[model samples]
Target chain A: MSMPKGSNIGQFVVIEEGVKLGENVTIGHHTVILKDTVIGDNVTIGCNCVVGVRKSRNQNMRISNSSLDPLVIQANCKIGNHVSIYSGTTIAQDVFIADHASIRENVEVGPGTIIGRGAIIELNTKIGHDCTIQTLAYVTGDTTIEDHVFIGPCVSMSNDKYMGAREYTLKGPYIQEGAKIGNNATLLPGITIGSSAVVGAGSVVTKDVADFKTVVGSPAKDIRYLVSKEVSEHDTTT
Target chain B: MSMPKGSNIGQFVVIEEGVKLGENVTIGHHTVILKDTVIGDNVTIGCNCVVGVRKSRNQNMRISNSSLDPLVIQANCKIGNHVSIYSGTTIAQDVFIADHASIRENVEVGPGTIIGRGAIIELNTKIGHDCTIQTLAYVTGDTTIEDHVFIGPCVSMSNDKYMGAREYTLKGPYIQEGAKIGNNATLLPGITIGSSAVVGAGSVVTKDVADFKTVVGSPAKDIRYLVSKEVSEHDTTT
Candidate 1:
């Protein structure tokens, strides 16, 4: 129930006790900031957002009642409307999370990331700096994304091989640095997208994509090398 | 505000003036119904929903201050939690819109249409009766979906050719009757899916699909005819 100095909160908003907010924060209407949450300076949260909420739906979630580290949002972040950000997550500075996006518990998102509208980042995922997760994309649980990665709209990355039965060791995709995944692409579980690789739109990547390669179509065959000097020169000329 | 007989309104529900509600409607907590909205009998609207909202952000939208038709929802439709339905939309009877689904303005959804969880139907789309739009699917604007069409999970339909550059008469894919689009498939703009056509999982449909054809892969080639007599005979024999 403690409000930091110079912070502006909108109507019908609820900020519980032990929630630490920094200066110059603007919280929009109908937002709920739960207990043990922490926000840094110059943050803007839009309307109808639920921050630090517990994952009540997942039966297998590693939910702890013991005192733990609060959900943290670093400086200069913009959170859009109708977003649900769960507990035990840390978001770095200069992050833009757009409307209707959901980020589950135990996730760490690095600085300068843009999570687009309606995107869902599931539990236990770690996304590095300068990444772009486009609109309506799904980054499944336990995924690891390196810096400068771009995931286009409607991209879906799965984690579980055997869906919803007895759970095996559910490991998601590992996307390396400078990788680009185009629109409507599906990455199967435990696969690796190598550095600087380009996955074309609507590709179903079943196996590991090699570095500097472009993959397309179902089961995603390697089409061409992505990082030729001629290609860079051609781009500069264009 | 006129309360119809035998309707149950939950806590924090906001229904504006000139909104007409039918009998036995159950509106959950924190749901907002704007002005000029008309609701039919036995409709169950879940929590945290925003209905009949105008698209305030689109500067190119056809916004009018004059009198217009109210947003309409017919009887016995179940709207799930956290949904946003815009104005100038009509949802027919027995339609089930699942959680986190967003239906935009000027859309007409026919009876018995199942819009699955997290599906987004863009503006001015018309979906016919008994159509199934599965979870996390995106139905782009200016689309026509016929009866008994099944769009599987994570399917994406795009309406742009130039993609936010100069728009070329943006029209989405037209899905004919009994067409089935499998999981994670993508449909490019201005394409027609003929009757009883089946698009395989992870397919990228760039052209028109013929009637009764089963297409697969990127640029979706026809792999087989769906309605063979031998298949029907085998099914009956089994």
Candidate 2:
């Protein structure tokens, strides 16, 4: 396969065959882009990143022998250092995936999302547009996050309520539009965060959160609202 | 220097000089082992791992010139993919460090410990034998995790109470023997988790946890008596 036009690659990069890149892409040092990966224009991937790898982790190990599909990175996305994007994933345009983030296989992340540093988006997750998953969050598998959601730093979502006893099928949270999960919150399996709901920091959410409600504490209970505020002091994407 | 006898080195591996490997050590693809690393017998390191590197991250960036010691990995350890172990650390035998686990420099991890997937044990941490640091947990710098302690998933421990304001000296928690920290729990700096105590899931611990007590919620308060269970259900090292 021929190299795409105007793609600048750094030292010790290993790009396998059948990988395609668009123009003005900057691939950083010590990156390994595996086969059947496609990159769009104006993408900048940082150092020590691994794109389209077959994941070997215990929670998200998926190595498909049946005609491996391509991992696609859309235009204007910025991938940070030491990131790992597995195969069978499609990142939409203008996404900013931060450093040490791991996007597992069969995931679909929509446009304008910011996956924060050291966050783990597990297998088969679907994240929609304008979402912000903050630093060190653990988003479990089979999750569906809708548009404009904000998952805070160190938020932990679980797919296994029984802790891998295999009693139930694994399913992560279904976060609706504009829902906000605070830092260090824990969402149990298969729960739904309603539109504009707020799960407070360090909360353990054991049930579904209704629309515009605010929940706090362990087995998070609803509290009366004091004041309405914007999601963050500053917007993530300018 | 010649390759170590019966050691299986993978393709495109970058091993520097004066690194010693024992018999039956299997190093996977795209791994970079730096100088002065000593790997013992029957060690299995997975793909894209960086062992014994001079770390570049903040709070662990110690490229020592005076008395630069080698990183030592003892026998029968299993290191998973994309893991990073910094220099001047010693990992004892039969430890299982899972995928994306980062152990920083000047640290010592004892035998039979399970450093779980995506867990980050920061600089100068000392973890004893039979400890379970579960998935995505963040053990901050200068911590001491004693034997038979079970630190749960996404448990966050901090060293800097001043939020990097440089007011007080930084120190993480000292978790004593047989302590159990539940999922999404946050431990404040310079605190002590006493022996056989249980910090409940999603709790924000502001002070020291007493022995044999169970603490819950923000500024965690204790509940009444519960039977002390062993931290590990089964022994990690047979």
Candidate that would win on TM-score? 2
Give each model's whole-structure lDDT: 0.85, 0.83
Residues A1-238, candidate 2: write the lDDT tens digits. Answer: 5657887898878787888899999999878887789999999999878788754432223343421567899999999998888788999999999998888778999999999998988778899999999998888778999999999998987665544323577688899999999998888778999999999987889789899999987768886532222333235444
Clashing pairs in 1: none
Given candidate 2, what's the lDDT at residue A26? Answer: 96
Docking class of 1: incorrect
lDDT of 1 by residue, A14-39 (tens): 89888889999988667899998989
Q: What are the models' TM-scores?
A: 0.72, 0.75
Candidate 1 chain A, run of 10 with poorest lDDT: A60-69
Recovered native contacts in candidate 2, as a fraction? 0.21
